[model samples]
Target: MFQNLAPAAVDPILSVAEAFRADPRPHKLDLGVGVYRDANGNTPVMTAVRYAEQQLAQTQTSKSYVGLGGNMRFSRVVTQLILGNAEPTGWFTMQTPGASGGLRLLADLIAASRPNATVWISDPSYVNHAPIMRAAGLRVASYPYLDVASGGLRREAFFEAVAGLGQDDVLLLHGCCHNPSGVDLEIDDWQQLASMVSQQGFLPFVDLAYQGFGDGLEQDAAGLRLLADASEEMLVVYSCSKHFGLYRERTGAALVKSAGSKQVQGKLFELARRSYTMPPDHGAEVVAMIIESAELTALWHSELYAMRQRVQSTRHQLADALSTNGMEAEYLCHHKGMFSMLPLSEASIARLRDDAAIYIVAGGRINLAGLAPNKIDTLAEAIVRLAA
Candidate 1:
């Protein structure tokens, strides 16, 4: 059995991370993985998370299983955080290992419910989206997304593809900050999508991994809520890895909105049971403690705000540096969250790594948060030289 197995394909993102780790260059830059890093080049745990853990360690008594749905309190608070004051009558939420887990769970749900449904994603979406959906036996396809040269959405092609979707389709959208490209859909785009989804009957599936990293928490969730308001049936996957800084803990949830909430809830539990059975509770409990307490919640909000500002500041610094180096990169400032695709060719990307010791993932995506402030000029210079 082992001898018959084929060699595994290297992961595009993780392989870049591994190569960066193996390189001995002291001034090497890593813009491959999507994790957030501070100006000091650290992914520091938030103060609120620290306090919550301390409280849990002292007061909590049990390490018992959190069941198939994990912590209900965490699900409720996070749902409220995502939906705001929107009516919650048709929603059913359950904890998963992370947004990745939530994605798979919902993919399985879609496969179970509508076996022939075609799950349509952006042309260049999160690297794992298509594979996960396909693994769950759902057909995967792409719609036109980014115009690489301009670093903007391909608005006409996008709406054209969306216009064709119907009842047998599932439109998977990034809730706020789009991964890899960082070009998000504006509110008007979401509004238009809501109208089309309502009229065309395609189910809206949103993956919200970097909620607070784009805009404010509420602001980032606006499009998702708008779509939710318009569609009677929807699917959502939420992650605490970014905003709550719970990356290693794998805390997140899968949410479904349908008139048949009871049936959806049962199906989610059944799917979860055959998979992980229960999501890890430590991170969810920490999140619950923070959200439930006023003081901790405020502290978390402030810390998240500072992180968002830092990413935005880095974006501006990089753009300015690129301009000074005789390259126009104003689009860097316009892209949201931690990532933006530089319009670099494959040869340019390879030259960036081999000649400049800069590690960017394939497709020219750079993590703005991963770059230290002092290295912005270095990156800008490398990019300018390579492009020239």
Candidate 2:
């Protein structure tokens, strides 16, 4: 049975990471991985999470299994954090390993419920999205998003692609801090998209990985709330990985919102019961404790603001560098979030890696979180040489 096994292609983003790791130069920069880094080029654990962990280690009670839905505390904490006080009835929720695990599990749930459905994703979305959706045996399609020409969302092309979406189709949207391309839909744009959801009848599936990494937590969740308000049914896969700096802890939850009768919710609950049976505990529990404590919650928000401010400052630095060198300003500083696609051609990507000892993805998605103030000039020099 194992004789026919084939080697698989490495993940595009991970491949770049591997290359960066193998590089021997000390000056080599890694704008590859989506993980956040401080000015000193380290992924630091947030203060609140550390305090929570210290408390947990000293007085934690049980190590027993957390149920099929993990901690109900996760549902409560995450719902309040991600969706505010809104109650979503007829919804089935389950905690999973992380956003990646949640995505895989959600796709599985979708497949079991509607096997033949086609899930739509942005053209250059999070690298893992398409493969996960397709691996679950769901057909995948792309809607226009980032424009290579302008280095931003192709607004016209986007609305056109969603123009004729089928009623039962699934559309994946990054709730905030859109990966790869930082371009986000404005509030009015979200209203239009919500209208499309209402008219077309497709489910709006949200991938909310970087909630506090964009604007403030509440401001970042605006689009999500807007959609939930417009949506009779929606699916949200929430991740605490980035926000809590709990990357290795694998903390996340899958929430399905529906407006159906009690009978339908019961069926959804049973479906979750059969999937992973239970979810991890430590990460979610820590998150719950932090959120529940007023002081910890404030500290968490403060830490989140620090990270957000740093990424935004990096954006301005890069944009100023670009403008200084006589390049267009249409896409750089104006964009929001942890990532920015520099409209670089595949060859430019190769050149940066080969010539400057600098590296980014072939599609040119750089994580603003991975950069520091000191390195901006070096990166800017490289970009100007290549693009200008």
Candidate 3:
């Protein structure tokens, strides 16, 4: 039975991380993985998270299952965080292992509801979006997004693609801090997309992984809320990994907004029951505690704000360093999140890895959060020397 089994395809992102670990260079730089690091190159737990864990340790009593929907309190808090003042009558939320699991669960629901439906993603979307959707037996297609030449949105081409979407299409979008590219849609752009989505009748599916890492918690969620306000039915997959520092906890949610929310919720619960059964409750409980308490929520917000500012500062530092080296990289400052794609070819990316000990993911994505400020000049020099 094992003889005919084929080798699994290597994950593009994880393989880069593995290669980074194997490299023997003492001065190697890893900007491949999309995790936030401080000035000392550490992914420290936030004060709020640590405090929440302590409180959970003292107050929590049992390890009983949290049922298929996981923590309803967590779901409610996350919904409020995402939708803000939107009416909650037609909304449903369920916990998942993480955004990845949430993505798969929702994909399964889409497949079950409409097997022929096509899920449209950004041309250069999150690496796993298409694979997960397709794994659930859904057709995946791409719409225009980033304009490589300008390091900005392909506005005209994007809208042109959106114009063709109809009832059978599910448009997947990055809520904020677009992965790999870091280019984000402005509020005006979201407004236009909402109008187009309302008129075109395609279901809007949003993946919000880096909510507070972009501008602020409220600012990052603005576009999603705008889209939510206009649409009667929508799908959202949210992650607490980035903002709540719950990466290992796999804390996330799948949210549905429809007139028949009860039916959709039942479908999601059934899908989830067949899979992981129930999401781990530890992280969700911790998040619920943090969000429920006003004091802890304030602390979390402050920490999130600091992380956002640090990433932004790193972007500016890199841009300034590149500018001083006579490279035009002002576009870096305009990018919203932890990632920004440098225009390097395959050969250049390999050269960066081989000659300079700099590990960047394929497609030139560098995690500004992973880069330390003191090493900015070295990175800028390498890019200028090797890119030319």
Candidate 4:
């Protein structure tokens, strides 16, 4: 049995992390993974989360489970955060291991309900998206997204891809702060997508991982809300890892919206029962407490706002430095979120790693939030050398 096991390929992002950690260089920088880091390169727990945890530690009575659907309070709170004021007719929400788990769970549901459905992902999407969908036995398709050569989105190609979607297809979209490629849609583009969904009869699967990390929380959900209004059926995967700094806590939710008669909530509950039975309670309860308290909620908002501003500032600084160094990287300034794709080839990325001790995904996707502002010039110089 051991002899029959095949070797697995190392995940590109995790491989970058491993290489970055092993490097002995004094100034090595890692731009892999979308974990948010402060200006000092520290991933700090938000004050709100800390307060909630303290409260739970002091007054918690039991370590009992939260049941198949996890904490309903947490589910409602997360749902409200994603949907905002707009209330869809029939919607279902469930606590998941994480956004990754939520995505897989929804994929499983899609496989169960519509075995013939295809999941259309962005060409240069989060590396895990396609794999997760395919693992569920769903056919995967690609839509043109980032044009690395010119450092911009191929809007016409993207529109054509969306326009060609079939009724049994699900278009997977990055709600905000698109992973890998930080390129996000404008209001007009989202509106166009909503119209396409309405006309094409396809479902939208919105992945909302970095909500507050992108634009404002409310602004980030704009596209998802628009799609909810336009499309009768949708799937949303929400993650708390970045916004709440709860990476290891494994917290998130899977949301589904369908017709009133579909009993989607019951189906989601059954699915949760068969899968994990129940999600971990600590993180979800912590989030619920924070959301329930006005003061804690405000504090959470403040910290999230500061984090977003820091990432934005870093992006501007990086773009300016790259531009001054004669590199075409203005897209960094325009894109929102924790990650952005650099206009670098595989050879250029390798050169940066081998020669400059810099690490980024092979496709040049980098975590803009991971940069220390003071070191932006150094990173910019390395990129300029390799890209030039």
Against the reference, the lDDT scores of all candidates come to: 0.93, 0.85, 0.93, 0.88
Return the lDDT, model 3, position 250: 97
Question: What C-alpha lDDT does candidate 4 achieve relative to the native structure?
Answer: 0.88
Q: What lDDT, from 0 to 1, does candidate 2 have?
A: 0.85
**Candidate 3 lDDT, 193-272, residue by residue in tens:** 89998898999999999998998889999999999989989999999998988899999999998999889988988898
Q: Candidate 1: lDDT of 315?
A: 95
Q: Write the per-residue lDDT of candidate 2 for residues 1-388, one digit (tens) a residue.
A: 9888899978898889899999998899999888999999999989999999999999987798877678888778898888887675666676887988889877876887789898999988998999999988999999999877777778898889888787658989999878888988888888898888887888899999989887789988998888888888888999988989999989999887876545444554565567556677989999999999999999998999989899998898888887787776557676777888887788888888988878798788898899988999888888879754
Candidate 4 off by > 4 Å: 260-262
TM-score of each: 0.99, 0.95, 0.98, 0.96
| The 10-residue segment with the lowest total lDDT in model 2 | 260-269
Provide the lDDT at 265 for model 1.
91
Tens digits of per-residue lDDT for model 4, 1-388: 5988889867989989999999999988888867888888899988999999999999999987777888889998998899984554688888999998899899988998899999999989998999899989999999999887766789999998888887899999999988888888888898999888888899899999999887799999988888888988889999999999999999999998887435766677777788788889889999999999999999999999899999999999998998899886777888888988887799999999999998999888889889999889999988898866
